[model samples]
Target: MKTALCIGGTRFVGRHTVEELLAHDYDVTTFTRGIHDDPFADRAGVSHIPGDRTDRDALESAAAEVAPSVVIDFCAYHPREVKTATEVFVDARYVYVSSGSAYARPDVPMRENGTPIHDCTPEQATDDSAESYGPRKAEGDRAVAVAAVEGVEAMAVRPMLVYGPHDYTERFAYWVGRVAEYDRVLVPGDGGSLLHRSYVEDVARALRIVAEEGEPGEAYNVADRNAFSLSESLELVADALDTEVDVVGASERELAAVGLEPADFPLYTPRPMLVSTEKLASLGWESTPKADAVAATATAHVENGRDGAENGPARKDEEKVLEAMEETSA
Candidate 1:
């Protein structure tokens, strides 16, 4: 069986990535702290390796044992962490799960080459952090590009606003949930803020492609080329829920006033950062139609009791995190 090591494979895109890997018949071993309950920690064809990414010694010992054919790092925030992981697993192909946010100031219809600088703010990336999130992540991408991993091909995939089942971020789901209840949906900033969306499954599929067919040292934008504005996304959700919701625009400043961070939105936009996926498409990767993705998201929201505002499927662990966030803010 083909062996794959998925670091940080228990949530969001990572969870979907693991499921996709397993479906493809890869012998999957997931490395996480198992801090909370994992739905698949006990499944057949998968092994759970408990370790901390920040702890190099623990990671190295684990990597030595797995000796996987491919390594996908899904939760790497610091470039150094990636360097450590790559250095230890010198024989495995590395697929770095990066963010479109790494493109600090991308031009319209963002291409991988257009991200000019590592321009994340100090607040976002912090000191001891050389690059901001975008730039820092880009730097990590570059490190993996020339990785010393013998016979190990490395590639980076930058996905934007990944959403689907099991999303606790509730960023996209918030809009879906809110609109399912309130007739007026408030949008933070001009509705025209162009952005990209990728269904979680599409992102998982792209990662598999990178493992199977991606070119070494290549950075591909894994985005839905025909991205929608924040307004359009809201409209899609409204339609999916069979509900009519008014779109009320609020400035970023206004959002901050309410103590809500704009970055928290699933349809993220500090500025216009639309992406072009012609490169990935040429590689035969395509995102799900936005309408279908939206509908699925809406369906999940409805099943979770979002339409009624007091009900929805509750995954206990995710609910704890959401509750903590709300409590802290309160």
Candidate 2:
């Protein structure tokens, strides 16, 4: 069995990717801070190593001990983080999780070869400050791209807005939940703005594929054909819930006036965030349709009450921190 090391495998896309890898029968080892609880804790074929990736000695020790064939780094945000990981896992293949924000002001249909938002060079370390999420990740991408040792290669996987079960952010869930309640939905920019909607599970699967089959030194955009308007997404949610909903057109500034930013902008914003998945598609990957994916998400939302809609805290990170604290105490 092939051995794979996963960082940040206890939540979100990382968690899903771990499950998918296990389903494919790969021997998996996960590294985390022992923060979150995983349902797979009792699974027969899995192993978890508790440590902080930011701690160079701890992470390096884990890497030297595990020596996995592939290291799927889902948690790294800074270029220094990548450097720390690479120093410890020099012999393994690397697959870094990046964001589509790395694209430099992308055109409507963003391609992998699109204008880069930042130069991909190791000399330029990514700034990990919260505001520079995109640029930092891009720098990490470059760091990994240039630092791989002989017989070891690295690839980067960038994904856009990901929505699905257990999504604590509730960004997508907020829109879906509002529509389900039969409320007047706000549509940003006449619902003509297009953004790539990727189901989290599909995005997870794409990450696994890129780790296993993607070309080294290249970045792959893991998005589906479901480029949609904010209006279309809301309609899908309403249809799934069999609810009558109203959508109001609002500009970015208008949404901002209501305490909503483009980041918080609901399903109908018209800014195009298209990405060409030809690179990933060439690897024979398939994704669920947008409507079906959202329907599934709606079902999960109702069942699990993820996001603040269910009366949880506003930010997913807050909930995660609480969960982590609980785990630490336990």
Candidate 3:
């Protein structure tokens, strides 16, 4: 059996990637920091190696012990981080989980191009500023390309707006909670904004596909096939929950009064975001239906009890927005 090593495999997308790898009958070994509990480690074909990835000796020791055939890195954020992982897995096929925000003008369905370089530097990439996330990711992506280990090469998987079970961001769950708890939901502007998102399952499936069959040294954008508008996708969620929500298009001013910003609302892109998956598809990549994915996400959110301050605006805050709208209409 082929052994696969996943760094940071106990959390959201990382956890799902491990699940995908295990489902494929690969002997899966997860490397983590021992900060959380993982139910997967209890399974028949899974193992856990807990330690700080920043610790080079520990990382090298574990790599030698596992001797993995494939390594999927889910936690490296900059070139320094990438260098550390690549040094350890120089002989194995690699998958570096990169971000779509690495593009400067990710306002569109970005293809694998270099125009978005908005000036990439080692300094900008190494910093931890909110502004540095994308640039830092770009630097990391570059590192993966240059570090191309001998024999089997690495494939960079860039995913956009990942959401599903174990989503600590609570972006998608916020909408799921709104549909479940409130009849009148407040949305940004007209809520016709379009954006791209990669479901956790979809991303995991693509990662496995690339690991097994993808071309080396090639970067692929792993995103959903369709560009969905906020209102349109929410309708699918509403249908899933058997609930009708009177969607209100609140101006930014109204949201600001309620302490909400444009970014605070999930899926708040002003334009269409249609990321190209042609490269990934050429390697046999497929996706779950967008409608089905959205419905399943809503169901998972409600069942997982993700409704709280962590998800997004609290119910009380939403209720206050409703009150304001009601007062305006009255």
Model 1 worst lDDT window (10 residues): 308-317
Note the residue pairs that clash in candidate 2.
Answer: 192-270, 193-270, 193-271, 230-267, 230-268
Clash counts for all predictions: 6, 5, 2
Report the C-alpha lDDT of model 2 over 1-330, residue by residue, as the tens digit: 888899888888887888888988888889998778876698877798988888988877777778788899988988888766766777777888888878877677778776666654443354445557777887877766776533447888888878788777777777766676535655545666677878888888888888788887788888776576677777888887778777655555554443554554443333577888877888988889878887888878867765345432233433343344346569
lDDT (0 to 1) per candidate: 0.75, 0.74, 0.81
Task: Give the lDDT of residue 314 in candidate 1.
Answer: 27
Give the best candidate by TM-score. Answer: 3
Per-residue lDDT tens digits for candidate 1, residues 151-186, read 557788888767787787676776687677667655
Between prediction 1 and prediction 3, the one with superior TM-score is 3
Q: Give each prediction's root-mean-square deviation over alpha carbons.
A: 7.5, 9.1, 2.1
Which candidate leads in lDDT? 3
**TM-score for all predictions?**
0.81, 0.85, 0.92
Error of 2 at 5 (Å): 1.1
Task: Report the lDDT tens digits of candidate 3 across residue range 1-330.
Answer: 999999888889988988899888899998889888886867888899988887888789888989998999888876688877887888788888988877777545578854363456767867878788888777777777777644447778889888777887888887888778877777788888877889899999988998888777667788778767788777878999998987878888887887987677767876676688888888888888988888888888888888534646666776777788889899
CA shift of 192, model 2, Å = 2.5
